[model samples]
Target: MAAQPSSSVFLETYGCQMNVLDSELVQGQLVALGYSICQTPQEADVVLINTCSVRQLSEEKVWSQLGRLGIQKRRRKELIIGVLGCMAERVGATFFDRMPHVDLVCGPANLDRLPGLLDNARRNRGMQLSLAGHTSRRSATLSRAQDGVESLDLSRASSPIDHEQGVPAYVRITRGCNKFCAFCIVPYVRGPELHRPPAQIVDEVRRLVDQGAKEVTLIGQTVNHYVYA
Candidate 1:
C-alpha cells in the first residue's frame, strides 16, 4: 500500500442511503487502490458525485452539483470528475450532452468496473467509457465488483453510515425493468428487467453483512416480478 495521503478525496453523495452505500463502496475500493478520504472538496484531487434519479427534481440536484464541480475541474486539471448510480444509466450518453463537463458517467449496474473506468476516464476524458458496456447490452450477469464481499460493513465505512433499520443496505439486486408502467419511464429508459444470478445475489448480501450493514434491500423498480432464466 502507498503512503496514506495527508490530503485526499472529496466524495459528495446525493439521493438515498443506497447512494451513500455506493459511495462507501467506492471509498473502500479506492482504499484498496491507495486513496485516502478528504473532508472538503476544496482539498481533494478527485470529486465523485454519486447521484440518483428516482425523480426529476433529484436529477436536477445531480446536475447542480456537477455544475459546481465543473468550476473545480477548471481550477484543478488533475481533479477527476465522475458520476455514479441511477442518473447515469437512466440518461445514458445523453448526460454528456447536458453536462459535457463530467469526465465519467456510470450507471447503477456498472459499479464494479468503476476503478478501471475511473482510470480510463482520467486518461481519456469520456462518459460512455466509464458507465456502459461493462455488463454488455444483452448480458444479464452481475458485476465483478459484487464478487467476494458478502455485504457492506456499515461500521467499517470511513463515512457516516445511515443506520436505517429495515431499509436494506443499498444493493442493486437486479437491473433494468420489463414493465412499462404508465406513470414511470424506467422500463423505456433503462430497458427490460434482467435479474442477476441467484447465488450472486446471496453473495452480495453476505458482502453487505461483512460491511456492517444489518439489513439489505433488493433493488429494481418492479423487483417483485423479477426472475432469471
Candidate 2:
C-alpha cells in the first residue's frame, strides 16, 4: 500500500498583533487537521499569507509577497495559496485581478471555515473567498487574547524562524465594534462589539500554550473595556 503524503503549510503574515494572532488561530486549526507548518513558501503544499488593511503601504507589501507567490504557483500548480484575516475582509481578491493565481480568500470571520474553503478552491482551481464576517454574537467575547495584541508593521518581514512556531498566539475574545473613528473602518465593516466570555478566553489561552505558544494578545477596539462581571 502506498503511504499518503502529509500536507506542509507556510503562513506569511504582515500587520498587528491581532493579525499575528489571527495567523496562529489559522495555524492551530490547520494543524488540528493534519497539516505540518513549513518554513518557506517554496517548501509548502499550502501557503497562507495573512494581511492587514490599516495602511496603504501594508497593502503594497502584501501584494508584493503575493507577487512572489504567484510565481511559485506558476511552477507548482498544486500549491494552495490563501489570503486570510483583515486584508481578506478589506480587499477580497481584487488585488488578484492582475494576480489571477490566488487559490483562496479566507477573510477574518471565515477563518474557521478554512478547510472547507480550501477544498472548494482546489476543486474549482479558482478563487475561494469569504470576507462576510461571522454571524455569531460569540464573535465579541471570543477575544484572541485578552492580555493584548499588537498592530501590524508593513516595513519588516518575518523570517521563517519567526514563524517557525509562530509568535504570541492570538485568542479572539470579541468581535465587531461600535467605534467608527473617522478615517477608519471598524463599525462600518465589523458592526457592534460581540464578546465570547472569560471562560472561553482562558480555554483558548491554555490551548495556545499547550501548542508551544508563550504569549497571547486580546483583539478588539478598546479591548481594555472588556468586563468579566
Candidate 3:
C-alpha cells in the first residue's frame, strides 16, 4: 500500500514571549497530530498566525500577512488559514467578516480546542471558532479545574531540537491580568488573571529540564502577581 502523505503547517507568531510559547504549544499539538512544520505558508496545507493586539503596528503586520494569505487562499482553495492569540480574542467573529479567507479563529484561552477546530474546518471547509468571551464568568477554582489551559501546558512536548539550539524555554505561570490600566488591552483580551497550579508549573519545568533545556523563563501578563490559593 502507498504511504499516506504527511500534512504540513506554516505557523507565524507575533507579539510577546507568551505568544511565542503559545505557538510552540500549538506546533507541538499539530506535530503530535502528524503535521510537519514548514518554513513557508506556500509550502504548507495549513497556515496559522498567532497574533498580538497590544499595538497598532502589531495588528497592521497581521493585516499585511492576512492579505498575503488571502491571495494564497485564492490560488490554493484547500489551504487552511487560522488566526490565533490575543488578536483572535479581541476581534472575535469580526475576523471572518474582515478576512474572509481565514478558516479558523481561536483565542489563547481556547487553545485546547484548536485541534478539533482545525479538524472541523478542514473537513467542513467552513469557519471554525473558539473564543473566551463571556464564558470566563465561572469561579476561579471552577475555571482552573475546567479550563483546558493547564492540561495544554502539561501536555507540551519539550523539543530536543530547541534544546540543541539553546533556545530558552518558556513556562506560563499565569494567564491574563487583573490590573485594568487605561492604556492596556491585556485584561480585556486575555481575561482575568488565573494562576496555574504550582504543581503543574513544577512538572512542566521538570519535563523541560529532563529534555535538556538550559534556560527556562516564567511568563504571564502580570507575572509578579501570580499566587495560588
Candidate 4:
C-alpha cells in the first residue's frame, strides 16, 4: 500500500506559562498523530492558536490574531485554521460566526477530541466547534460536567516531541484554579484545580531534559497550592 502523506501543524501560543505548556501538550499529541511541527503557517496543513483570556488585552489579542489568520485561511483554501485552549471555550460556537474561516474551535478540555473534530471538519467541508469537552456521539450534545480543563497526566509513554530544543521549557505540573479571587477569571475559564501525579511530573521533567531542554519551569495558576497525592 502507498504511504499516506504526513500532515504539518503550525501552533502559535499566547499568554502565561500555562499557555506555553498547553501548546507543548498540543504539539506532543499532534506529533503522535503523524503530524510534523511546522515553523510557519504557510507551510502547515493545520494552524492552531492556543489563546488566553486572563485579561481584556489578552482577549483582544486573541480576536485580532483570529482576524489575521482568517485572512490567511482565505488565501489557502485547504488550510485548516483552529483555535484552542481558553479562548475557544470562552467564545464557544460564536467563534465560527465571527471568523467563518476557522475550521476547528477546540478547548483545552477537549484536546483529546481534536482528531475526530478535524476528521468531521474535512468530511463536512465546514467548521467543527467542540468547546464542550466530551460530546455524546449519539445525542451530539455536550456534557456540562465534562467541560472542565483536562490536566496533564504523566503515566503515558511520550513520543520524541521536541518543542524548545536546548532552551528553557514550561512544564505544567498542575492545572485550573480553585480560589477565584475577585479580580481573577481563571476559575471560570480553567475550571477546578487539579494536581498532576508526582511520578508523571518527574517523568515529564526527565523527558524534557532528554529533549535538550536546559531548564524546566513548573507552572500552574497557584504553584504554591499544588497538592500531589
lDDT tens digits by residue: candidate 2, 118-226: 7677667567877665442233333443322211111012212232376655566656666678988655444456565677678656755665667777776658656
Residue-wise C-alpha lDDT for candidate 3, range 64-95, written one tens digit per residue: 99999999999999889999999999998999
How high is the lDDT of residue 212 in model 2? 65
What TM-score would each prediction reach against the true structure?
Answer: 0.69, 0.75, 0.93, 0.81
CA lDDT of every candidate:
0.64, 0.65, 0.84, 0.70
Model 4: residues with Cα > 4 Å off, grouped in runs = 1-6, 132-165
Ranked by lDDT, top first: 3, 4, 2, 1
Candidate 1 lDDT tens digits, 1-229: 2423542667877775556767777787677667777888888777777777768888888788888888877888777777777777767777678777777777655666666666666566455444444343534443543432223232234434443343346666555676667887555445545566777677766755765678767765567876766
Measured on C-alpha atoms, candidate 2 has an lDDT of 0.65
TM-score of 1: 0.69
User: For residue 92, what is the lDDT in candidate 2?
Assistant: 67
Cα lDDT, model 2, residue 68: 90
Candidate 1 segments exceeding 4 Å error: 1-7, 16-18, 94-98, 124-128, 131-168, 188-190, 203-212
- Candidate 2, superposed: residue stretches over 4 Å from native: 1-4, 133-170, 188-191, 205-217
* Highest-lDDT candidate: 3
lDDT of 4 by residue, 55-169 (tens): 7888798888888887887888777888888878788788889888888888766777776776676566577877544332212112233322333334123433453556677
**In TM-score terms, which candidate is top?**
3
